[model samples]
Target: MRTLRASVLARFSARASSTLAFDSTSHLDSLQHTRIQDLRSALFKGGAPSRIWAHYTNILNYFNYDVLPLELHQQVLRQCSPPVRSVRLSDAKRLAQGKRLEHRHLHEGRFQAIISNIRALGCTPSLDDYHFILEHFAAVGYHVGCHQVYQEIIHLGLTPQTKTFGLCLQAIAHRLTLPTFEVFRMRLVSQTRKALDDLMSDMRRFNVPFTTANLDLALRIFKETVDEEGLNKLVKWTYGIDLDNPDCSPLDLLENQTTSSPQPFSTHALNTIIDTLGRFGDISKVVQAFEVLSQPLPQAKQYRFSSFDDEDDFGVPVHVPSPSNHSLPYALPNTTTYSMLLRHISRARHSTLARHYLIQAFKLDRQ
Candidate 1:
């Protein structure tokens, strides 16, 4: 019942936001100002959740849902369901006072109840509102709550935006990291698989394409769960290759490029992909990814350590081989790439492989 009411109101967040889309009179502004101020006070001044709740109810009663300004309502939403960053600060404060953070149901109930109340007042919640709730939950540690909110959005026949899918992927990935949830690891992986299926269906339904961010979230989950097959599918997806085709080469992305074209894999982006593969204990793939990036354009005066022990710490000549591939992304990995590879390779207990990377890193320090 609590979840139901929250879901109902969750929809209204969107509707209520745009209700007075173009204009709000002085009458509306004044009514919202006091309550918004009070809500902000409670959040920042270390007021108890009970006090925050009090200010919240006052806002509801003051506007009667009919004249609730979007700013005020979003403020209440922040209090009721903060993103992970806010939750961490609030929790830290609670810990200092030797109190647990507020109970889950209080927040869940309040969040949905806001949506329900908005709808009861005959304001339809907008899609933006639904995304707000889901995004908050995605960050707030209510990983599954993101799904619950998403389910209700669908139940109400609401069309979600691309960001919604990204949020849902984030939520799905988060649970796999929690120690308390480790015992349910397989179940969490399965949940991600289901979310992926739902995402594909929705993609077709709305004609919305999935973004790299979406693929990255799913990759995070697969990385945690050590789901090699799952990682393979997404890695293929990430490179714009067909899942069923065996003939595709990641190198194809480089080959199709025009000479001197824009480098597709910037160093930071390639490092992220390398890190993802690293997480999967696939150092070979990591090295392949690193190699695939066109070596950085050589500096006119290349620098290398005189030797490992030379404390000079200045640029010296270190000749780097030029790329044979005429068309490839001209990005090169940095020390971080070395660190990621070493971390994962060491994790697999292969000291020799780790040592090889350290040597490679020492050789590449000219960058």
Candidate 2:
């Protein structure tokens, strides 16, 4: 039965093009003279006629990404009711599965048909369905499909959960070539701000569990807006409040001060901050943050090192020359220690200091 259904679906798709061509020529004169009233009258008189399945098949035939007139396309949507729309969508999905259809071609057809159907339904598709389509299109790198999905979400008055919103944002962020970034920044900024405000209000009013992931997304968008100072201020405010009152902040409950390793931030958040800092050439701030993060706690004295050979090598021991004190013993330098420091310094572009260590590395290599 499934195979039979699949075969019928394929046949319908094959015939769709010819039907579309015939409709385009025969309807061209009427379509050119058609008013919105005529279209509305056709839709309300008996939306989704028995002939709709055939009409849909014909419409699909004429649908080319490059050439379809938007008005005539919308008129076809007006002819379908919800049930017919659903049927058409199912047919589109089945047609998309054909091996001969390229990803781009399939995506364009499916996207246009799905969007038109959504318009006919007078409501948005469920979030799960929207996500499935968005992910499918995004994987194929169909930017137009992705944009349509985003616009549909907005048009449908659906506000996705933080995780879902974050995933969408990250997907766009990952694919942000320079041109795409510029376009996204211009097109999405206002919509994004409204969405962010809605999300923030939800978090504040409902006692919704705002995870680090949520904060990370907010941070990323802020970075995109080129508001580093604003981001830093927001972070300081939020973290300070959380630290001062653990009872009020879910994030505080997750903090682990006893662990020596760094806590993981969301990769999206970290990447955004790193990219922002790099763009501004604030290398010193990066180094300073690393230095502070690397510091040992007072209770961690047992983990701190006094000698380069010490197993707990958290702190380095180095001597500075003094004008009056001359009785200090000549310390035997650890070549391994010097070599490691040289590697770090070189990577950080402190070439002069690195060169001194490089000289010692050569001696150790000789030994």
Candidate 3:
């Protein structure tokens, strides 16, 4: 019985020794990972010693985060340096390309650690850095969290003087539904007028041409704020017409009657006016605006026909009896009488009558 007890004790001691060996191996592996992360961090810092990158690459090849403790994993990332310019442009490019290629292998804890460090430092990251983090989050298909990062930047008040804020705004704008527009308006209005003004000024100063779709958005907002008279003034002003100039009406500007070279309003601006008119249900006013657009002025010469065979010839002319001459005892031929009446109506550009004739022709064809 004593021999059996001694044998059992020896077996237990051997198992304990094996467990200790395993633990020691794990601790060494953990230490190596920490060292590797430290090397990677050093490589990112702007003024690190030249030998660091080589060691970083070597350590990166061996370290695996799957088995590491969460705390140690974080420690690894915390030890890393911020990205910096490489010794050579090619080296920098290589680093970028490598990151692009291997970014998928990046651990989430490491990223969180880096971000926490960035926040703690209270330094606004470069646009590239922000975009990198954004892309990282996006690649994981986690848009909600990505938006939170943008919100964080705004909350921290680190978004000033950065195009990243504009990019974030644009992204949110694109994703915004009608239901979200109110929220967008509230948030945008909450920004300081200086910030808003700076954004607008940058847009103009950079000559950054906005798309028609984006301009439509601006027009929608503008329409919501301005009354009819104010809107009309805006339209005229956009065409370089001064409303305060008693000599120039909106029509005069449309006609390019000003002394300066005629600078017509853009098609987008014109469309905005047309849309505004339609939204107000001013169909007749819209037609009047079209007429004003169609009319030939000094700036826009009317085309005249020199000869029937000329390419520029408009069409053949038709003669019509005067309205006073319609009282004839001798009845005119039915076709000729109707043709003369139609010619007179056409000369007057009677669109209602023209449509009536078109409908009658269609009915006659059906018959």
TM-score computed on alpha carbons, candidate 2:
0.38
Which is the better candidate, 1 or 3, if ranked by TM-score? 1
Would you estimate the TM-scores of all the predictions?
Answer: 0.59, 0.38, 0.33
The regions of model 2 sitting more than 4 angstroms off are 1-106, 140-148, 177-279, 296-349, 352-367
Q: Per-residue lDDT for 214-246 in model 2, tens only? A: 566566666565555545544433342121221
Select the stronger candidate by TM-score from 2 and 3. 2
Order the candidate numbers by lDDT, best to worst: 1, 2, 3
Error of 2 at 78 (Å): 22
- Write model 3 residue lDDT over 1-367, tens digit each, in one string: 9999999999999999999999999998787868766664654553343345345335546654333333433333433333322212333364566532222213444455455544445544444555655544434323344456655655665533334444433333322221234655555333322232344444444444444444444445444433355445434433443323322344554555533332344544544554555455544554444334323223212333344553334565644322221110111123332343344445557779657655654565576
Per-residue lDDT of 17 in model 3:
100
Q: What's the TM for model 1?
A: 0.59
The candidate scoring highest on TM-score is 1
Candidates 1 and 2, the one with greater lDDT: 1
lDDT, residue 266, model 3 = 51
Candidate 1, residues 1-367, lDDT tens digits: the string is 9999999898898788666563566667877887778787887775765677788788767666655555555556656554557765675576578774332322677778778866776666778887777766665446668878888888888888788888888766755553444576677667767776677567557756556677567666666666666666555434433223322344544356422222244566566666777776666666666655536434323444345443335655555544344323445667787888788888888899889889888887854
What's the lDDT for residue 14 in model 1?
72
